[model samples]
Target chain A: MFLIDPILNVCERLGRRLLMLFSIVGRLVMFAFHALRDVLVPPYYPKLIGQQFINIGYYSLTVVGLTALFSGMVLALQSYTGFARFNAESAIANVVVLSITRELAPVLAGLMVAGRIGASIAAEIGTMRVTEQIDAMTTLSVNPFQYLIAPRVLAGTLMLPVLVFIADIIGVFGGFIVGVYVLDFNPYTYIQQTWDFVQAMDVISGLVKAAVFGFIVTLMGCYCGYNSGRGAQGVGAATTNAVVSASILILIFNYILTQVFFS
Target chain B: MKNFKIEMQGVKKSFGSKDVLRNVNLDVKKGESLVIIGGSGTGKSVTIKTILGLIKPDAGKILVDGQDVTNLGGNDRDEYLKKFGMLFQGGALFDSMTIWENVAFGLTQGQKMSKKEAYPIAIEKLEAVGLKESIAQHYPAELSGGMQKRVSLARAIARNPEIIFFDEPTTGLDPIMADVINDLIRKCVSELGATAVSITHDMASVRKIADSVAMIYEGEIIWHGPIEKLDNSGNEYVDQFINGRAEGPVKF
Candidate 1:
């Protein structure tokens, strides 16, 4: 009886898919609540947390540090060329420090960890799930969330800020090297400029962003992996989905945080 | 009323739109070995799992020792689960753990026994299962299929639980290995005097292990009797499944 019957049916399909999307989000939120709630509770596994801290923070230092350093160098080099046109080349130090601390360091480190650690968490958990190790834990009277997930989430949230702080320092140092060596800037003047221009708020905001990013990385990994489908192909899909979703969420949260702080 | 170790009255469950278990009733006496036999997906495993509290039934009640476990959670659930042990279909041994650690998992993790104390007990259980103590340090991946099944069996009975559940205990094993596992199962159940419930399709396993047999079809126990009366059960569904007949009420 309706003229839009065909269109309405197509709309129903789209609506169903959208409903599924929200359902997944709802599931993720509930998962996060359980994971975060247990983070500070007793029966805490210091042994497992200590292991995850080392794995997430200590092992990741080299790659994150290198990325920060190289990005800083490139930023300094490019800004010098850009500012030289207007004879504002003196602003190179300020720009490099601001960009690295406010956005670049946290973002690059987050993306890198998302690729490396997210895929690892997802793959490990997915394999455990398919092989029935998670079920085995349940049967053994162990809470899988407390034993498997809480430690990693707590470590990721607590450690990433520290990693990003290190990245901020190494990044500024990298800028210093390039500005002093390749750009023929005065080392003394460059230091003075960086020190003078950098604000505490800039660094603090970046560290906050890093902490949130770290939570996203580990959480997506565990969620995707825990709910992974059956078999090797299923594990592979979970790994890919974890990395892709974590990276996307990082970018979205970055913009939102920037709007809150800067706009 | 006889004191049954475990009992389920009208227990029912479904997965989404698919009703896997429908109006199932079962009972096991203390120290009795009851094997539930059926074709795959006929609710045999689901029936046992429902009793284990792994899957909550959508309807009816599940009782253990005359206590209702329908709404158990938190400490109550943990205490309930501590009374039982289960061997999964694929052994479900933690690959990350060594053989002894896998056997002693319940003692150390659930009961909080010191590892030093649990390790000796673990070695003893492994020895009972005919596995050498030398393999105690080896990983599950290093073991063969039959060895893994034995290790899983060892783990199941390790805690000396009051009740034990074996899901397809002899599946995925060669004939000789299946017979060996059957003997071990019989020995474990007899020595511990535990209430044992097993779900299996292997007829040979049923004859060797079951003191009483219940045959499930379409989520219902269509026929149940002692093992000696099984061949003459006269129930077509039970007859068809036991004979493995291609032409029967069970659809391919």
Candidate 2:
């Protein structure tokens, strides 16, 4: 009887937690829908979108570029060492190009952006929420969904692909530099192998993943910030949640997208 | 059959298990300055927020000019919202914008006026708030608390709104600065012929700006009367609140 009661208690607790998780996801989905609907309406702020583009896409360039470069270089070094043990060193270019284009560039850039842009969006909007700036916006007859969330979400969606495309090129260049300079490989042959082995679908899939990850990052940020609690503690918690949730979603979506594209 | 600019009938709101407002009933006349006085967490802010459609009441009807605005939505809500301006307690000016841009936000963004057209009006509003034209380009963060509050007031009046709501307009200010703000509020509302509703705990501000006063205690209006009758109000809660007495019907 005692053992059965403990099992029932555990089940009840698990059920409650599951309900809470579903509630949060439902609210997030509804928020995204409203934001997207507002984005299609009139009163579009091209100026705000431009500002967010600079913030999310341009400002994130250095960190994303650096991360992608290192990831690609590491991939090349690791693959060379691993394949050398199996007399499969000739396939190094194919592995490097495939990994960089299909996985590393998009995922790394997405993570970096989720950390940088996601945290900033949450902090800025959360502070505004706590300080009553969002309320002030509503009082002024401005739809915050249109004025605040739409521009940011739109920029994140559009700019992420661009950032990832740039990252893809830089990442490939990093792999090439390591493959040729460090590995003592013939640069021409390595380039030929990369061009021959890389498929258009691989790069396209990564860009698509980048776009989705971008949407998730900004949406989570807006959701967390808009519903932030009062004061500094609330804003700080929101910032942390935005980054953590965005990073997790990016990884989850990466796998799902890879399945859809390849599997 | 008095022409009420705003009316709340049995309006109640609760957050989770806590009741913030319970059966709140009030009325404001056209072009009248009605100050709602209460201690913190007494639902003074919630009452005004419900009127503005920022917070939906759990139950009851809110009528603005004889129209039920309880469930207004979509374009109707937007159009309805256009008639009023609100001054948030924290001087909620947009930090991203310059002082002039903050003032002109409603004009440019809400009314869709071009920047060229709105700039002059923004400056005009700023100047009306006793700020110089040179400060127009400065940001809200660069200003003092008093100046920022003035800018928020400027933004509120920029649209020539029919109704103006001030939430703790004189809070966090020195006595002289608070008086200056109170005077500005009175002058602005009178000049615009706007129905003004303000929430504050400051007796001095209440005396300075209120044509009529309503005292909220524990989410309900305990006493309401003309400004002149505040001192001699028969209600113990009102007397306790006004006299700053710790021992009264109002619990800590």
Candidate 3:
């Protein structure tokens, strides 16, 4: 009983520390919401918006699509092998479409994009902030918030859904190719079964998750960049923090949104 | 003898408990070139940053043309900013932009000039700074350090600002290139009839460019007078800094 008491106390302390970390994250999220509020109020920079869209969105498509496609193919193969025991190999299409659309596409896309775009944004802006270029912009009649933050946040929110939609289609196609050619399922039957199980809710839920994850990724990037301390080491720290925090937030938000949409 | 264009009276700034600028007072006449000489980390950059309103002062009155500009905001701040130009220590050119585009950035973005209008003006400024028309399409990274400094100087004067700030404009250049840059700075400032405030540790630049010199020590102006008086300023900090002595009041 005495040993058990000490173990329970340590668990309580760990739980408390986790809650404190969560609260800090929540405050940062609230600060991001305010920054977004400032963003929409305008004196907009369309040039910066277009640039970031190309940078964060267009540049990210190949990686996200490739990840989704390979993940879908592997998932179909695994499911086929597992269901073969019961002679339920026909369930491969249902499993591939459902898993890719509901979970894998959005999560993988979000994480991959987070690593690529989030780190770059943080590092670029973090270097600028530390080098006093951000301050120079302010003194040159440009608002750093309006010029820097608005376009990035806007691009992340608007572009991720489109990327995720493309990822979804490509991923499902990957599964189709694997299921039909490799596993010898009839093409028509595979497509039909895929359509039968995937309702509009699944696709919509994934897109919603993408949009939320995009916001988390970009907000974390910009926040870390903006608050980066003075020097190369500071910028590096901000870049790493942005990727890690954005990835974690994406996963956590994925679970919460999943519960809301599914449960 | 001319009217003062910008004035900082008892400006004080602190980051937490560490006071950076302490009771800094300065005045720049309408068309005079004022050089501030200080050792590294003596708040030379911080003083200029405060006047630019990049770092808000904890206490001070900064006046431009008799208006208290310390607390200006929004369009007012932007309007005030248009009157000034700055040449940053690193040139700070936008990496994504061409040389001409970087030169014309303020004219296009802040002034809302058409690219067609801004392009010719950018070319003219580039040429004025001894850069050829062929180099206009090249990016900042393609330029040599001296060329980059010339490009930055061109950008600084692109708007024909009433006031210009130069922060360490000749730091990394060879002696001949530094002199050329100093000469360009003088010619540009005089041609534009702009009041220039320069902060540098380079005494050569100070001698070449300054109408009046101010020596900053421990975050305050310890000595200020005409450049002719710099050789006989008699202050220990000024003497030590200008001579580049290792044994001085300003210990590294």
* Model number with the top TM-score: 2
Model 3 complex DockQ against the native: 0.46
Kindly report the docking quality category of candidate 1. medium
List, residue by residue over A1-263, the lDDT tens digit for candidate 3.
Answer: 98999999999999999999998778787768777876788677888899999988899999998999999899989998899999999889888888888899889999998999899889988988886678767656777777788789889988898899999999999999899889988999999999899899999999999898888888888899988977999999999999999999898899999999999
DockQ-superior candidate, 2 or 3: 2
Residue-pair clashes per prediction, in order, are: 0, 0, 0
- In model 1, the runs with Cα more than 4 Å from the true position are A1-3
TM-score, each model?
A: 0.96, 0.98, 0.90
DockQ for the candidates, in order: 0.67, 0.85, 0.46
Whole-model lDDT per candidate: 0.91, 0.92, 0.89
Q: Interface RMSD for each candidate model?
A: 1.3, 0.8, 1.3
DockQ versus reference, model 2: 0.85
Query: Model 2 over residues B126-171: C-alpha lDDT tens digits?
Result: 8888999999999899999999999999999999999999999988
A202-257 per-residue lDDT for model 1 (tens digits): 99999999999999999999999999999999999999999999999999999999
Q: Rank the candidates by TM-score, best first.
A: 2, 1, 3
Q: Candidate 1 vs candidate 2: which has greater lDDT?
A: 2
TM-score of chain B of 3: 0.98
Superposed on all Cα atoms, model 1 deviates from the true structure by an RMSD in Å of 1.7
CAPRI-style grade of the A/B interface in model 2 = high
Q: Candidate 2 at B145: error in angstroms?
A: 1.1
Judging by lDDT against the true structure, name the best candidate.
2
lDDT of 2: 0.92
lDDT of 1 by residue, B203-237 (tens): 99999999999988889988878888999998988
